[model samples]
Target: MRLRPPDRFGSLVTLRLLFCHGAVDFNVGVTTGGGGMTGFSTSDLALLLYQAAQDKNRWPVLVAALQETANPFDDDAIYRNPAARRELLDQLLPHISQALDMADRFESQAVSQNLLDRTLEMLPMGVALLDDELNIIMLNQQADRTLAEHEMLANHDGHFKINNREQHKLLHHYIERSLEDGSSHALMLSPGNPRSVSLLVCPADLVKDRDDNDPPAVTLFLSNPDFQSLIDEQTLTDLYRLSAAEAELTRDLIHGYDLRSIAQRRQVSELTVRTQLKSIFRKTETARQAELVSLVLSGLAPLRGRESVTAKVADDIGESTGLRYCKGAHGQRLCFAEYGDPQGVAVMFCHSVRGSRLEVPGGDSVLRDMHIRLIIPERPGYGDSEALDERTVDDLAEDMRCLADHLELPQFHLLGYSLGGFLALHCAARLGDRISRLGLVSSLAPPGKEAGKPLKGMMRLAVALADKAPGLAETVLDHMARTILKNPRRHLGSSVDRKLLAEPDHQERYLLALRESCRQGSMGFVQDLQAVARTPLPEPSSLALPVYLWHGEQDGQVPADQAIQLDRWLTNSELTLLPDGGHFFIYSRWPQILANFVAE
Candidate 1:
């Protein structure tokens, strides 16, 4: 077949180009935007026209500008010209593809950089990136702070010496190993400084997709041992659902002590200790001892300690056989110990708000051994006593009235401690005709702004914070214990009695009382504080009964001034102050106080 030269602007230019040099009869077509012609050979014509356009210097400028500009093909002049449009599309398509490829690479690089930045920022420990030759590539913010603080990393070279050579060696070994194995590794680091930090060293290579030839980098997570102290009490309490007693148990458990050892230290039987442990386990959902220990170490456990003397007292009380139950006003069940003839002088002993009938210091032995008829009712929400729907001094007095009626006693002696003291006073006032004597030991009266300013503030703050963020209760309590309870000069002191208070046995009882109160959902504390803030007392005047008040000079929570104020307010009342004592002075000097009360 004879070959014909392709005509300029040929309609079948593309088809001729395709089959002219071959036997294949394939037909090709091309379409230009301005649309002069479309056939098998049109693509060849378009290519020629585009090449001609490119020969002009304006083609490179136009193509480069189009690549740089936002929307290149939307220009009207390029769309209108047939040759210009074809030429532009040919050039623009390849350029646009190259530009898109570059943009994708840039975006991927940015995303990776962002991920690396976020990872570094979130780390609590210092992190360093090093090159294969041991040159510093980068240092995270934490690393910068640490190195700058220690005067290390002064030079850009990766030759900084950690304060502890042992830790540094270990870290270096881990880094070397991770580089060799191309796997993530870890090590512990301890700096010898006062801010002695415990650190976990981890290989950073796990975060990146890199080969063995890539230099090893490490991330160090710093932990402060003292940070355990900073954890709030409420947080621990809520986290572990710890009652006061369980908090004490947790402390012993964390110290690697067994339940029996803890029981011995607290002067309680092992079974009692086990019971407390079971309660703790149920609340915290911990089945193993190790998990409990970890919870304590992580500050997820509450503050709990053992009190030996209190536990001993509890043991003695548990041995008592005589048990009597009386129905108090407000439908409360009051349990008491009945000894001697019922017709004899009836004595009613009220324990502190955080106390139960079984926890009246030496009341049980005193009543049994002295041949006295004592009516020791478990206060509302305590022991066998029914929980009060509402907590108020008036409600407590009403309850007492019911007990008096239920027991059918015409006259009775009244004794109370701390919160019990205020209740005792109310009982005396309400049952003036039926009471014989009134005694207050380590008792607190109603608190006014001047009396309990700090305490009231603390309570208000606690309630507010708890309401705002219930999770922080344990943390708040922890801080309060350390700052308020641990300070000897403050309400909580380190006197002999105070030291004893920290004992395992004493703490167990204290915690038990607290836990019981909490379980009952009795807002006795809040109500008591509110009553104290509101109640007003009169000047000393002769009463129908004799009143005696006892307090410790060093009493912190309820200042000795409160006792003095009560004494001055009651005409028949006399105040006896104890030296080197505190809120729970009666516990330490129980024998002497009881002797005086019995003699009277």
Candidate 2:
């Protein structure tokens, strides 16, 4: 029999013939006869052939059909008639050829696109392609960083936007014109700044061998003067065999600093600076400063100095690296930080709302001296911890349970600060005898009419929104998180906290922690607010363990009255009021509080 083209009608007719013939032969159950095979039935072979035709990759199915009987194609004689076997092969070969051709095409396209994306990522300046609607069709890694760092340029939901209205209008007008005429345009944003933001927009059609159907209309180039790919000084010294001072001078020149300015900054004579510069030239094999800087930038310097602070267990923990994570229930990441001695008394500390594991203020020395192992867990959606949607205070308790089990602590002291107190109480109640003691520091009470009375400023507003309008609360918290991430020192903490962070070392530590807290963005904080608003917090009376309440007399976020209320509700509880301490009393009074936690 001759084969026909695999058109819809032809395929249907062929399928119908195979089905009918296979059914007739299968019903007869004949072996070594003219109508049927010896081992593999005709009906089974027909069904396999049908499936292979419908499938995308036909070779595997064809192979399986052949393997249905041992030596079906040879001595076993699964096919009693040569005509039948010959007919099936004629039908299957076309589809197998088509599938092979398609696979080749897909692999080629994927390889080409991957190469393009990687090449774009290597460029120092930000690059983006835009359609006529100003929607971002594609943006490279540098462009993503640029959008994050600059307040002016934004890529909102794939739409490119400029925050400043007048600048937006001007840039839009130019972009539209460029799209129409296939022209190029340039604009300077924040021109008054010493290092201004430069934007260059050109028509995409100018590029050679452009796609014909619905191609990108505009190409945008972004250059921020503040943006620099910093090469590590160690890397420089290792690569060029330069001394520490020579590496410093090389870095300065690469960043566009002149010899005289470097001399003034180093408090050395211009002659000494020139001598160092000559040495750098000799080491780098460069004739001039410009050549040296260009050579450095053109090499691996542009890709260096990028550091990631996210860490895991058993890794060498750096002083600046506070994010240590572990797998929690459902394999979600639960990040926390350890303070005090590694072998000290274990106290699982719950961080407050809008707080990270790094909020323990007095440094690790105080905890070490007090012999307390402070295990501060970033609640769901906070810091480096994975966000759990629709989470509750009870869910946070479960996370604590997972963390404790992960650390192999059968029983440990528990403490909570601010909103964390609610989570601590929940854990204490749920974990039963596992919790040795419970401590609340400037903690909030169960939800009530007067629950939010003591709250002020953004905190008060957030609670109100969480109660009445959760979506708005998330938006507000997201904005606040971005602001905090942008400038932690300016946006995080109160005036008093800022004063405490006045020392550069203190400021750096605080800022780094704050950044890590918002690293996963505002979802963690939003989850906290939603949990607070909806979940019924555990009452103080439910927990049988000894409760310790430490409240600031001037506490503003959660009132001192709440601590008094908690003290009265608990059957066995001790309450302490700090006359001078406020919401942040944990920082100053942590040593004493930690000592009390481990004490009998």
Candidate 3:
């Protein structure tokens, strides 16, 4: 049958009709009549048509009818007759092509919008998109919040306007740079603002590809400084413990500025500045500017030889190998090093419990050059010395005496550090007439039970644990070594002269000795603690020998106040405080300490 053509047909409608007709006639359903109907009912035909449309069969006539129909289901009048349906499809082909084109355009727009929204949401920093004229197109949540908090941008006359004067200037500069130079730029918020914000400006082309019609655009990212990143100003105030005005003065003092300059800067009277300085001096316990500077710079000072008591001692023994082993009180082999003239007046150097004879700098040289004998004997369980089974403070003193007698020396001078200092004091008290002089560096007398009960208990527990479980005891000792003596580098702080400590390989050698001493000195240290615990301190009047006590004012481990107390106890004793020095004050201010000791 010849069919009439329909108008307003498109390609999509043509494809739909072709698919529907092909499915019903061939693969979809059964035909009924002899004329090749296959017994399919009207409802069956309609279901077959729907499936055919979805399957997209190539049938030109039905496809044309689908293209022409505005609504295929509503075009029943023309579709009722087979010839009319065929004619209508031809006319509908153009309209069907137009409909397909519209569908595709709509889908592409939706996808583009979705992509833009997702990209904006994924950004970490606040972002605002603006047109060439600086009109806001869109902003993320972070950007909105930042602008509101800083009041940088405000809604004015139905448009967002830059409200902050400084921020506006910054924005203009940033935009100009981004456009003229094609570069990214950033600016920090003004200090006058309560909140910290950073503005980053970049060409929008940096984010998107450039198109002919796309105007010049800029993106601004606003960021606030994290509070967690800043140190608390209050902590500085508390560390110095100064009032507001005094704190300002202290800062000037640290800068080496004169009081008059500080007053002028603060627009205050010089008298006021002087008053603050005096208050600062009292609070810091400093008497002079040098002392104050020393206190601050002690950590920066370089390690040097022990303050020269006299001159560097010559190697009178004429032997490079000065170290030797001797029998201690308990018949244990004690490591010893001799310096200077053995027949000259002997000076015995004792180290702390976890210290070794190696800690003394220039011992052999000083001993030899000064024409004075030097005996540096390792304490029990220190260096190569054997550990003592039973020990007391008096026992150590007796051992010292025995060593002095063994060398055939009638009398000797004594010097000690930390625990060794206490032992030296004890020895001086016992051998008042035999000892010539005493030097104690960063040492403290044993605290009485009334004052040291807690410490005593802790020591006792350690001793017990070590005796019961040697493995656990070793672990505890390792922890102590790591936290304390192992890294003297950390303690050196600003006081350690890097150049000097780095020279002569002394710092490395000293640290090595420290570790070795800790590993081997545990047993002797316990014995020493026991000794101090049991030995009764003699009356101050009993000590007639000259005693020199030195301590570091900044010592955190041992309080310098202990030195003051000891000075009061011993009438003939002299106390010197090292400003800004720590427990290892001797290492920091060794020159002065040694000179004073020699002069005495």
Candidate 4:
């Protein structure tokens, strides 16, 4: 019998009649009487059809159907009998499985390539795909822009070369070495240009690129150092702790402006400009003008929103209470109280170990007379300030720099009282040129076993607790604060006799300052105690600024010996030994301190 004509796809409907007749005949052991090959039986008959097609017998219909197995359903494989359809599907199963695997692999590669292209497009740095010959086989958007900006990475007729002959030769050597050893390497290239870039060459074997039979040998990654990518104002402020005026000068100097031009633009005298540059140099820790510019272009710090000490003084300070804030590193808050004239010459007041900003009353007439913008910074973990577990004298000095920068003061006078004297020296050493002059009032010296023996008994106890068990120190100070609040005269002790606390106003102010110091706990007091114990402070003799050491001859907290030693150490210094003053002399003698610092 003749089968129906094949469709264009060479497909056929299910031939159930053939399977019904043949399977039944084979299973039941039935055959035609002629005993010819009239009835089909077993898989032996299906195998013969496959062999006939492989041997190129005249079986076009069966061969074509095998070739179309991938699209069998789409080819409309119409069969008249269900038995014939099931038999044909079983015979074509092996060919259909192979076709499915081929399609899956094709789709996977297409998706992978698309994702790679998109990712490369979004990169901020330049990237180049290089071949064995060091020619750029591929590059991304940033790479193209970089090449256009700087002729260092030049392209000629679709090949890339470093413009500098020396750098070019170096690039060749590195690329060849990477391919030879199948390793990765990195190098920085200056190309004798204003800026530089880092070139990272990784072996092709390391990257995930399956489609490249002869993969590119090396990949070069480049950083973009465009001329217009200068550090912003806020970045400068946060990074170097520079004031608005200082940061502006830094920007001008970085862009190659001379002192005269900067003065012309800012409408100030050249002397003012020179002073501002010196302040910028001190803050950024660069000694030369060229170095300052280089750092701004290449090594500026990331902005962290660290405003200068003056930024929020007017806004955050309560007009009635004189309370303010200064932000520290890592989102820490520094509590300070502002007193005196807002626009007056800036003078910082660092409190004694047992005192807060209120050590001097907020609205004192003496401070206003000197026209001083009095800034009293609470040390870490003091007053309403947050506690820092890791604090160093140098770190505290850096915080003071941030405070000065915020206040927009390029130069200021510095005063450290008691333990604060140790920290005052720290800042003076770091920023000697910026300080007009330095003054220490009964400041504690680094402990010399014999010299430190005369320190107050109560202070010694506080130091022991802070050094051995800080948690306990906090508790003790808290209790002490409460006691002082209950009865100020009793807690006055030897630091200040009951005579000072006789008036209600004097008692009230003294108690208020104590409350601020101990309100947050004893962390600040303990940190100060621990800092004084730090050894090998920078030499007072080495400082560039003048230092004044004042001590009470009758003092017990810090004896007269400390001032004598400081006098011997400082190159530009004077030791003023008071005849009958005590450790608390600063509260009474600040007017004199302010007058001396304000004097030329």
Q: Best candidate per TM-score, number? A: 2
Clash counts per candidate, in order, are 41, 1, 51, 12
Query: How many times do residue backbones clash in model 1?
Result: 41
TM-score against truth, every candidate? 0.42, 0.50, 0.42, 0.44
The local lDDT score (0 to 100) that residue 123 gets in candidate 2 is: 64
| Alpha-carbon lDDT, every model | 0.55, 0.66, 0.58, 0.63
lDDT of 4 at 35: 51
TM-score of candidate 3 against the unseen true structure: 0.42
Which is the better candidate, 1 or 4, if ranked by lDDT? 4
Those runs of model 3 whose alpha carbons end farther than 4 Å from true positions after fitting are: 1-319, 341-344, 449-475, 482-486, 491-506, 519-521
- lDDT for each residue of candidate 3 in 18-128, tens digit (9 for 90 to 100): 434421111112232343422223344344334333322312223222223322232233323445445434443444454434434654665686686666654445777
Candidate 4, after superposition: displacement of residue 341 in Å? 1.6
- By lDDT, the best candidate is 2
Supply the global lDDT for candidate 3. Answer: 0.58
Candidate ranking (lDDT, best to worst): 2, 4, 3, 1
Question: lDDT (0-100) at residue 164 of candidate 1?
Answer: 61
